[model samples]
Target chain A: MRSASIAECGHEESNAVKETQLLDIHDLVVHFLREEQVVKAVDGVDLRVKPGESVGLVGESGSGKTVLSRSIARLMANAVIDKMSGQVVFQNTDLLSLSERELERRRRKSFLSMVFQDPLGYLNPTKRVGRQVAEALPPELSRRSRRHRVAELFTQVGLPGDKASLRLYPHEFSGGMRQRVLIAMALASRPRLLIADEPTTALDVTVQVQVLNTLERLHREQDMALLVITHDLALVAELCDRVYVMYAGQIVESGDVETVLSSPHHPYTQGLIASMPGQRRRMNKVDGLVGSVPNLALLPSGCRFRSRCPHAFDRCEEMPPLMPTSTGSTSRCWLSEPEAEGEDPS
Target chain B: MSTRPDQSATAEGVSIAGAPPPLAAKEVSVVYRTRGDFGRRTARHALNRTSIEVNYGELVALVGESGSGKSTLSKVLLDLASPSAGEVAYHGKALNTLTRTEMRAYRNEVQVVFQDPAASLNPRQRIWKCLASVLELRGVRSQLELNEEITKLLTGVGLNPAESFARRFPHELSGGQQQRVAIARALAMKPRIVIADEPLSALDVSVQAQVLDLMIDHQKRTNAGYLLVTHDLNVVRAVADRVVVMYLGSVVEMGDAEQIFERPQHPYTRALLSSRLSIDASKRRIRDRPILTGDVPSTTAIPSGCAYHPRCPIAVERCSIDAPEPRVTGDGSSVACHLAE
Candidate 1:
């Protein structure tokens, strides 16, 4: 076990250029084995989260956004990994290649952590909040010191001083407080990258705003790399620096938040953005698109979105690679490609 | 059976008694019995003298978070759950004395589209069978006639090629499709009133919009009254013509949707609207809005005077001592706040 905390080592990785991409993933694939065949949950995904940036991985319920983030977090107990061939280069170390031990040793403590959706269920019910946070600290720390640090960690995450409140069981606290404790646990290691998977979904709207504001403050102060996985576009538009619209386990579009949200390049992205109630105010009710994501086990032959695509054509029969479109944004749509001879269905 | 609108007949038949105007509920309250390890108490005071009325062909939204009694009031209207106090009338008829057959007829007139489409639909049955089961119970004769009506209903809800969709099972379809099927099934009965309880809350954001639009469009075509129950203020803003704000089983505020949005008289209504994610960056700051203190009080232990006084930001001494009666605000909005007056 590594005795030293990365913060104590004074690693300069935190000082990496803000403009430079902190993590870049290309052609990332994650497959699950069923009885009959392999389910390609994340077939080919390209994702990039820059330093001091918050990016959103958005899709419907079964969309591969969760799987992709879990793969990076290395928390894929359910994933029957047929392959995860992709570059998840962070601080020049390929996360995919690192062994369990190397990954643990090189774990970007204080640099990478995750706050899951279910705050109450995430922490062990029987465990005290202080002890749960203490588990994230270095094992070398004595019981007394760990206890002291736990109180400080709780305070840092907006818990009250002395944390006599945290000394109570997990069930004792309210949902919002439990979520704050989860954030406290995530920050205990001082991770540079934070992968929050729908952290505020279960919370009330008032608490959701409170937690979101806290995240925004953390992202600004620590310059942390944040990848928010959520189904809410409104939340993404509010918080994320850039947005990646995922469909059928693959990123269909990725760009600046304003550009993508305002003028989406891909049809899927456009439908999703427009389908939101704020965007559709009785002019023409397209109801977004009419279909769900295709089954991963028996995915469509060509562009996965073609089945639901309003602009799908004959050319969509062949897979459309992620290409820089004429609209000055990246989109994996045959329609976006200028020279493509696909007939316009519209 | 007349297709044309008989305005006088419709008005006379649907209008509320005493008021001689439209349907009215005067102080409807519902209390449930609950027994815990400690002792016997109230399980939930689901509805607290929540007086609301939907005029003929008008869409009204009863909006509140869980335990606020939106669902309870919905049940009260359906007479599935009877109110402990106050009265619910249809036109001039009191509902509690209705025979089973009369209640069934009332149900045929008023239908509900639940929030969970999957749970509402029979998973074991095909989509057509689900619709067929209802039609069969209603005794609609002729297979060809029934089939035509089903297809028309499906098409009306934006499901093209109803035949193909009808053949599929509930699980085979998407969430949006399942909801469309549910809506079609509801319309198959040709109900005069539709009480949609959080219909779009379970759906994806984009899909929710589509469902809302469909519901709104159908209401326009049919001119049926809607009792929309939802926790989302945004949805109410988009679709509802009138808004009813419920708090701790009480109708805290009620008004035209625009009036409620522009000047929310009730503290609960104000908090809900303010808590909504505002696109305006300056208003997005959390502290600018007054956060409601404490969780909703247990229905059994509802406050002595005003149910909301415990959590109301501007609760006065009178607010805690005596419950404020609903009064028409100067702004033409009905508010049940002591401070509002």
Candidate 2:
């Protein structure tokens, strides 16, 4: 059923859906064992998603945003998992500590749900759209009951409810509709957390807006916490409340979305916002800073962004820990810290 | 026809291209015949009686969404795709009517830079080899001559020292650098007209700015006319001298860039600009929801009169039964709309 107008639903009721802490992650690290060395894809990142608050993980490609989000869902295979260490607390149990069989048993219900970038990749080509969503139903449901639930979900995500339409393959649906099918499947489980990584990136601008609106409305009605991963800062400005800016496998800045986007303290965050097309044009023709993300296998010595930072100094040679600024937001930059008195560069 | 009051008004609407020679396309149309889902052959008009002109050193923007036929027009102008009808005339010579030898001679005067740099280059070829091939095709033989031109071309596009980048391959370069190489390749021929097709869409937001600035500066320095094709209005506002707004393969509005932005007469143009989500957070909160009801219709099955009528928020009966002729609005914008008339 359609929820009441979003404005009518008081913030208290919206926040009161079991007041669940969906995923409590700390010191999450994913490393790959190369022939010569270990490369940390995700390093020392901590994240927490409450019941109904959606958090956006904003970063460019190769910023480790995708890898970190994927790892939480246990989508990465054991063979591909080189050396992972972290406490992934889910549903009152530390998921990282659970045995394979036990975690698999618990994963379907209370752990998490995910919508990947390529909707076709997540959806089976040969399988009927209804069957894909129905498979997420618990084994306790009989065949008829499962089919009935799938039809309800199809209508929930704004798809036609006709059984014949549901029987068609994934190719029959448009890109936006395929994404809706993926969302329907994710919501079928009614999991506490939903991780959508670049869900609307592939669609056109107007379609992207429509899909994002659907996602936001669903988050409110379902009371599901969301993790929206995307490279588009403009999208995050519209949808997200809090944001974490990642760079070189580290959280460079994290704060209220307005604070981070409007007046970002970190240099990388500033560059990212300034780099947006409609953001203030650069005073100089330098066009903000330009440098490729360093190869993950061969990271920089310290303060990974220092190589391209305009404010880099001698102190940046040492790795600056992720610390709070005067604004109370976390930023990992030497310049963000108030220097000791009488330590003058001039 | 010349003495009529309407003809005098139409003459008043034409803007002058301040230059030695005027570059223009006359009744340019591109039609493709394709089989329908049921195997019925149908004629698809990708571009419909479109005409565009750029002064000797003007930068004109062709703005349209996908299937609006902007790229098809670009390809036709670049001599890559032959139009079913009409002609592209530069300095009074029709491109379609030119002999093979004449076309080859004209190719050097009009070069195109494609959107994706990765797809534009031959992956196996070294950067130097690619640059050398352009010079070779133009009948330049000496190594010293090739080197001098290659260095100048690279440096012109902001690839400094030239030698460092000349030895690299397309894969070895970054996205911005690859685009620079593409620009360099286009400039190696010293073309008078540069047609860049959605050049920044594939790039990151910041890199897009840098590359667009580079192209703009190049245009200013070389005094070459630019025929830029893109769906982005923000880019058009920043770079275009005159903007031509297209909807469903027809020019719905055309005017000075700032004029169009300030007061768009066509509903399509108004909706396109207002639909974009502004980057400024305050503006995002303040602006009302866009009034665009649905997606652009497929080009294959265009509406009877105005292709945009079905989705037009303020469409009138005349817009559905009869196509509105291009008329000059009071604000100096040319619009094809019954309401505007």
Candidate 3:
């Protein structure tokens, strides 16, 4: 559905990408109707991805990272999307402003593509791997060229791309190989931006490392912008240049990975880092964050995270904006009032 | 059926190690019966001569990737399934040799908390009934006594405002809350040993940490030996006293957690450690030593010699023809790889 009119847009569409930024999302608000209750999945999210930039969207479950990313391409399938009001500008054009047919063309011809957590679900078990990957190619390509292009894409993503290898079914491939197939399929269109949502979470540790390496290679060689949405801060720390920490549907903090990871400004960010299990020399006895994520339907007013914040005070009766911190980071907490520079909190 | 309890029923008095391990597997091997194409039954060796012990007061982690037979070993110990070729014992009594009454007591003394809490908990039952039923099976008759015990069990796992949670059904609770209920039910047995299989994997990071801490607290208070079965090395580092690394249905390395983690000797163990995502960003490296290639072999057709030979980075000619025997090194570490020597 998102590819039909891309071919019809003709010659002028070839030079349409005049924007400096690869993708820009402004004040995005996405709400879902669940059992008659409004679920503010994403509220007033602002983010940008420049060409060749690698950014990490760090959040736990229910932080709306997935919804926020999906909304960029209007890719929410079979969901009760009640209210979606936002501008997803891609390459000098507002994608939201395009007509239904134009939006479909814009999405298919525009700057973004997505890779999901589950590889098995996306790939058809009964179909040949080569045919499955070729489905993502443009309709203008010859049948033989599509098959040949798929094999090339498979090799690009580090899959065994021999003729015989491409003929095997999805079931014959290992979990890591299945993910590689998905990556190859995702790369077929060669979009400027690739949104990978927990692409390595289900894989084994060894397999995860392999996939991360593949993603890094693509980011550097392909010159493609990457918006990696995941809960694994370690991967973000390793791969991404910039990081955004989200909590309860809003981005609470955003900064360079080192600055954000090393000295997190928001309490939620600190708690998330503390929650992750590292290689302990001795058995660690530290206390983790006290409670679970609040229900999206019954989310507290004022500050969404106030109920869980340890430093939450009376001032938290009102929402906090994404204000600048002294360490060149952005934080959404009243307590993070840009303490004096050169003062090491660690 | 009336029976006199053993003098060892006073589990609280057994302070620490040196006694016989509460749960022990002696050269246990398990073969599963599966039907292949053409209705031909095939026997697959899930566990082969795997010997493990869960000592009192120490948390031992059984770490392995998928298809490494870690789950098979856990099931064998739990007696949820029988081993095709070895013996599983509970407090020195072989599982097959135990009398019906003794076996029932053994079942209560060794409880297991599974990966999925929702599945472990009965969906039709209320939280209160779940705990109450466990207590009732242990011979708690009075309604008042049952309620008090249930509240304590729930509170022990930090499911507070116990009254509210007690009345709520399983579906009403979140994943974390449901897991807490599962842990509460498991704790109701007052087990001498707890086998938690990937308990924290399903949860979010914040919830995972809290649940891990709760399990640690329970282990300390009860001094029960814990067998934490998981693929996450970080979880093992956080709580486990000892570590056992498995690959392709065999123990590749077993030692003190510090020794295994700080200086892993076996190639398989080293690869596992290097593959882990460390929190320290400065040393965040992708291409490290011992980065193994290839996935684990199929259970039905395991590699002839050392199952790891195909993927081992430093495999020698000997590795392909002869499997290494378990060798005990100084400092109490055990490894079953020729290269480690």
Using TM-score as the measure, the top candidate is: 3
Return the interface RMSD of the candidates, in order shown, one decimal each: 3.2, 3.3, 1.8
**RMSD score of candidate 3 (Å):** 5.3
Query: Candidate 3 local accuracy as lDDT?
Result: 0.84
Could you tell me how far off, in angstroms, the CA of residue A333 lies in candidate 1 after the best superposition? 2.8
Please give the range of 10 consecutive residues that has the lowest summed lDDT in model 2 chain A: A1-10
What candidate 1 keeps of the native contacts, as a fraction, is 0.32
Q: How closely does chain A match the true chain A in each prediction, as TM-score?
A: 0.88, 0.89, 0.90
Instruction: Candidate 3: give the clashing pairs.
Output: none
Per-residue accuracy of model 2 over B1-341 as CA lDDT, tens digit each: 11112212223234454222335666778888999758998888898878777665778999877778889888877777777778776554566556566566667777888999999999999999999999898787899999989998888877876998999889988888899999888888887789999998877665777788788887888888999998776677666778998887788999988788878889988878775655566676312446465566667778988888998989888878898778888777789898875
What TM-score is obtained for chain B in each of the predicted models?
Answer: 0.89, 0.89, 0.93
Tens-place lDDT digits, model 1, residues B22-137? 34565788888877546855466788778888765778999876678989888777767778998766644566655566556666777889899999999889887888888876
**What tens-digit string does per-residue lDDT give for candidate 2 at A215-313?**
887887787788899887777777777889998898999988888877677888888776654344313233555665677778988899989787778
Off-target runs (Cα >4 Å) in candidate 2 are A1-20, A33-39, A138-152, A162-169, A281-286, A339-346, B1-23, B35-44, B99-102, B137-140, B285-288
> Order of candidates by lDDT, top first?
3, 2, 1
Best by lDDT: 3
Kindly state the number of residue pairs that clash in model 2: 0
Scanning candidate 1 chain B in windows of ten residues, the lowest lDDT window is B1-10
